[model samples]
Target: MTNIHAPEVLISEVGPRDGLQSVKATMPTADKLRWIDALAAAGLREIEVASFVPAQLLPQMADAAQVVQHALRHTGVRVMALVPNLRGAQAALQAGAQKLTLPVSASPAHSMANVRKTPEAMVEEVKAVLRLRDEMAPGVPVEVGMSTAFGCTLQGLVPEDDVLRLAVLLAEAGVDEIGLSDTTGMGNPAQVSRLFKRMFQEIGPLTGAAHLHNTRGLGLANGLAAYEAGVRTFDSSLGGLGGCPYAPGASGNVVTEDLVVMFEAMGVSTGVDLHKLMAARAPLKAGLPGEPLYGMTPEAGLPKGWV
Candidate 1:
């Protein structure tokens, strides 16, 4: 058997959900579908189309079911959605989401403040969702994203032990995959490496993706750090929407354009066509007029035929 480098990284676009959720304007369902179509055409294999929660809470995703249905029409593309609890998971499954992701806070305080539940409570919630999937979804995969794993505004310093412990609990709860998220964007390269290395040691193959924020301008660096530590999947938002409201002026997740450029420039294939990716931005912009878009690669213009 020959050793195969994982080829290219997987860029999971979260713009429709994370990006749109942060903005005041609700992107029209038709425009959202057009954007998703453009993104799929651009070679993004997975896209978080929406979050299944109370529309009163997040009016932006009030049409999550419609968006998920639209995404599912594109064969071969993984349609994912965010669920805060069993209710959202059930809705997403009914909407035909191939994967459902739940945000499990590592900090107890953040968990309570964000989801109104403790970490352990959230773990149980995940278990319940997993059970629902086994009985309902059957083939659908349930993933838990450990948010604020790096640090939190509500809680000053999050302990690594707590993060790892929650990872174990979530795993035992029967989640198919566990993802780490820098919700607060306080993550640095060193911290990222150490945490991921430790996580892999304990959870090993159970680790999934790194959901990073460009809040402090270290999103790409932290992503690289995680990738070097054997992480292949990455979560990013198109045009860097949905910045941490806690951290003003910071971009949401790592910019999809910048992440693709970083990987493709290094001869690592992302399977994402930069030209097509950039072209997809037009529809995204059209969908959310007046919303600020962020990306270095887009501004710098792809370095003269560097595909």
Candidate 2:
């Protein structure tokens, strides 16, 4: 929502952070840099490049600072990193991340399992991160990706009232922007539209991206629904590459290349070069050999005369 009137939608690629963290193998630093450069060259304006978690917990993200440093060299792209707590946020800030995102799960069961904290406690952690951001990196935005915002695997059918309540708490807590995530990919189009409409009603312009997953094959459907409900930013991974290790049955995010095709073909400009974006998979595959990459567009190829 940086430029509300801009015709193009913002596709924030999260492959490096979300995708790599989900897999068993760690991508080498050099290959990660090359892959990021390829993505930037394809005209992705924003990317969640890394997560600042402990190396022991997620070794794939052990080189968080190094990746941030490399991604910063790309002039126009907004380099973002995920921070789990104030400590991670401090590391990200010191590493020169332009934007920081913290995941605050709405389901208490998911929250305790993932971060070992209650929903309310996670809010306090968010407040602490905000305070630290204000002290260390004053204008840099701190976004909260409300995980399991739609539903949870552990605690099924997360109440809508609970989701809205957390949104209000996050808004009042002073997060720069609050984005809803289908962390478990349990969201449907109608549910997505309804929740997003409620979110905008409650927080107005503070509502951010649609971080939907394709686990149920409704990622694009839910994304379109959110767009109709006024969400301009979308979070996707390069090869539909991410899932929460803590959230059972969670799998790939909405694919970036397919998303661009859907929006661009519908006359909604995404500002991403379709061919170049597709080519980014080269480095991805090179970096993580034998890892399966998913995307219908790549498998089926762009339709004849697709602009």
Candidate 3:
């Protein structure tokens, strides 16, 4: 068995894809590659490099194939990409992505608005991706992320049973792992603990992670809650760069720097260098000028004489 207390947690950076997609200005592909390389050098082993969505829908991801191809050349980094459906999966697989994440929203309204498919319909799509992975890229894991798993801006107070049901459905659909996302930043620490505990109890032994938003400023706390509930992998964007367009001003994913600092400070190793990780942000800032970068640790600075 993989030890639950494996010393440090795995923080998967989603800044390149999640962060860049939310902005109006698109970052150059070369700059994106440089940023990914820098993050890899900083000891970040997993990164959601880009999404394989159509260029017309998300121009920011126009060069996702190129980015994925480049990221594959890096050793020791698990390259992940988001695919809305089978077509994106094929593109990602052709580009050599080692892992693929498919989003299935728990909120009906959010689901329809985002992917134009209901949760159950999305599960069917997940099944299709799984089949394709088996036939084409055998052994490549397909992950189903339950967005709005905590709460939703469109359909508020998403039921726990609903989220768990979809997770079970995805597992039955043959996905390798399942993840819970607070896409609209509606999650709190107590809610996180309750939901994750129930999830593990009902769906024990399945790999799970927390993809939280700091919209309400409880991202790190929620992460700790899920971690205590046995979640080892965390999905965060460097500098907290994503947010729902429906909910203006709500920060998107949790900041990787803050998440890493929280764990490492508690004597839990993340295998990520704080200074080196922080340095990797320069390219991100340069790529998208005038965009606000969010984080507390980066501003407060590491404590003096503190190792």
Candidate 4:
């Protein structure tokens, strides 16, 4: 397992990247840093702080390097960034990001549309990025969130065998870990559990985080399925800020506040303080005025007399 995952469960906050990218507005760097600070203070250990994409493509993440620099100040936070290719990886590493995530789609239709490459081609890209990682940032870990592993809106009903095969390919390519993503949010709990079990059988401990979206109102349920399937790390957005710009009908990521509350309530020990986590939403609201945020726990507040 990557040293980035600690405690019984590690919540990797992806709001700054996945959450912000899907939104229509570009939040200023100052407010972005404040939102990250609020997340860290709320005890999020790994925060996906930026996506190293071209400014024209994603102006919201135009200051990705600057954001990474700011997030690094938090003592215990493992600051992460997303990279689309070798160039993005270089930029993220140069910015001192402690961990990196790359999306490798299991569906060919999704792959070509999202990254302009096929599945096999992306593996080669992963190799290229690994070579660069070895050359530039030897110890920094690289993760691949294989998007559309469960299903795809463009292609429909991805084969579980294909997902497993690509995961094995990624593990053999020497990535630190490989995570499954319900990119289009079409996954059911049963499919989630079954596929993750097979992934474990194939890649062993190299299996990584679960990146489930709440598009069908199954994000938390899918997350529970992953945990029961032996996944310990999860990617979520604060206040459910996420959706794929490339995937039609893709929606918000599993909300960090709600996921933490679910796990903590089940005695799973996510290590996040619920009160502080709820308070962290303030910066998000402040950063992008009038942007709708989602979290049932935050909206309802903690239960009465239930510390």
Identify the candidate with maximal lDDT. Answer: 2
In terms of TM-score, how similar is model 4 to the real structure?
0.96
Q: Which 10 consecutive positions of candidate 2 have the poorest summed lDDT? A: 1-10
Model 2 steric clash pairs: none
Q: Per-prediction TM-score, please?
A: 0.96, 0.96, 0.96, 0.96
Model 1: runs farther than 4 Å from truth? 1-7
Weakest ten-residue segment in model 1 by summed lDDT = 1-10
Q: Please report, in order, the local distance difference test score of every candidate based on alpha carbons.
A: 0.89, 0.92, 0.88, 0.91
Clashes per model (N, Cα, C within 3 A): 1, 0, 1, 1
Per-residue lDDT over 1-307 for candidate 3, one digit per residue giving the tens place of the 0 to 100 score: 1123544688999999888888888998888999999999998889999999999999999999999999988898999999999999999999999999998999999999999999999999998899899999997888878899999878889999999888888888888889899988888988899988988887786757799999888999999999998899999988888765665663778999999988887877888888899999898888887777888888999877655
Q: Tens digits of per-residue lDDT for model 4 on 21-118?
A: 98999999999999999999989999999999999999999999999999999999999999999999999999999998999999999999999999
- Candidates 1 and 2 compared: the better one by TM-score is 1
Candidate 3: C-alpha lDDT: 0.88
Candidate 2 ranges with C-alpha deviation above 4 Å: 1-7, 243-250
Error of 1 at 140 (Å): 0.8
TM-score, predicted candidate 1 vs. hidden true structure? 0.96
Pairs of residues clashing in candidate 4: 19-241
Residue pairs clashing in model 1 are 8-269
Give the per-residue lDDT of model 1 (tens digit) for 1-307: 1114554678999998989998889998889999999999988999999999999999999999999988998986899999999999999999999999999999999988988899998888888888899988799888888999999988889999999999999877778889899998999999999999998998888898999999889999999999999899999988998875556675588899999888887877788878889998899889889778899888889786563
Per-residue accuracy of model 2 over 38-112 as CA lDDT, tens digit each: 999998999999999999999999999999999999998999999999999999999999999999998999999
For model 4, the superposed segments whose C-alpha errors exceed 4 Å read: 1-6, 244-250
Model 4 per-residue lDDT at 259: 93
